[model samples]
Target: MRLDGTVALVTGASSGIGAAASVSLARQGAAVAVVARRRERLDELAARIRGDGGDVLVIEADITQEAQAVEAVERTASELGRIDTLVNNAGVMLLGPAAGAPMTEWQRMVEINVLGLLYCAHAALPYLLKAAGAGPRHVADMVNVSSVAGRVPRSGSSVYNLTKHGVGAFSEALRQEVGQKHVRISLVEPGAVETELAGHNRPEVLETIRARFGGIERMQPEDIADAITYIVTRPRHVAVNELLIRPTEQE
Candidate 1:
């Protein structure tokens, strides 16, 4: 579980699971490169990590753009030495009825949730491979943060579900492609977590969610972060392919 002399890059690091995972990795002795679109939040996170005597590099970029995603990976590897771990956690969830859903929302979801993850994975793959072939850890890790929606299809979440399901499919294919190389590709599907992920929902959608889960206890970002840490911290021979974490009450 010790990651000393290794570097980890985390996307969507401004808040929620990304932020928590960054802190967790840093605590485990990995030099963390936190990527996000929000500079203020990234700086704040960096300050906290630095205060704890952990190394961190803040790279502010919107991974939805291919060039920006590439740059984020390049900068991390160039400046922080090499990327031993990558956590693709940037995503957005805009829930609503599919009949007359706003095209803008659907496009945004695909761009951020799907395209962004792809861009980051594409840009970081080479570095991950190189790190796995050499270096202190000898094995690299890529953890894609997906959702239970990927596995469960429900009404009013057609496009969001599509993006998540796509993530699962992509992760499995990549795992097969890169497994023998010692570059692990893992997928984490979270049922429901307390984060700002639902903040983009429309009023009606928000109300619908509130009514449904008003009494159900939601998991926290650290819960998912812990799962991610566990996957990445295993021995080189250990590969945790897929982890589905749902709250006990989240049937």
Candidate 2:
């Protein structure tokens, strides 16, 4: 479970699951590159990791842009050496009725949740593959943070469902393509985590969500981070392809 000489890049790392994953990986001896659009938040996160004697790099980039994503990956590889792990965790969930839903919501979800993940993964694949072939670990990991909605489509979550489902499909296909190269690709689907993920929803949608999940307990960001760490820490020959973690009371 040690990653003493490894470097891990985590997107959407300002807060929630991504932030927790970055810290957890660093604590396990990996140098972490935290990517997010909010520079202030990233700086704070970097300070926290550094306070704990962990190496960290704060990368402020809008991953929805292909060129920025490429630059971020390249910069990380140049500054930190090589990327042994990549966590494509930047995503947005704007849940509401499909009918009469604002086009902005759908477009934003697709751009950030789907396209952003694709951009980062595409940019980091070469470095990850090259690292996987080297010694010390001989395996690299790419973990995509999806959601339970990906596996189960429900009303008021049509577009959100579509994006997460796409993540699942892409992860599986890429896993097959890179498995023989020892580049492990995994998908982690979480159900009802307590994070800022719901802050982007409209007032009406927030009310609906509150009504639906009022009494159900939600998992913390660290819980999902734990799942991600487990997947990436497995032995080189062992690959945990998919993990679905739900709160005890979620179902």
Off by over 4 Å in 1: none
User: Tell me, what's the RMSD of every candidate?
Assistant: 0.6, 0.6
Steric clashes per prediction: 0, 0
TM-score of every prediction relative to native = 0.99, 0.99
| Candidate 1 residue-wise lDDT, 1-251, digit = tens | 69899999999999999999999999999999999999999999999999999999999999999999999999999999999999999999999889889999999999999999999999999999999999797999999999999999999899999999999999999999999999999999998899999878999999998887777999999999999999999999999999999999988
For model 1, the run of ten residues with the poorest summed lDDT: 207-216
- What residue pairs clash in candidate 1, if any at all? none
Q: What is the C-alpha local distance difference test score of each model?
A: 0.95, 0.95
User: In model 2, where do residues sit more than 4 Å from their true spots?
Assistant: none
lDDT of 2 by residue, 102-220 (tens): 99999999999999999999989999999999956999999999999989999999999999999999999999999999999999999999999998899999999988887998999
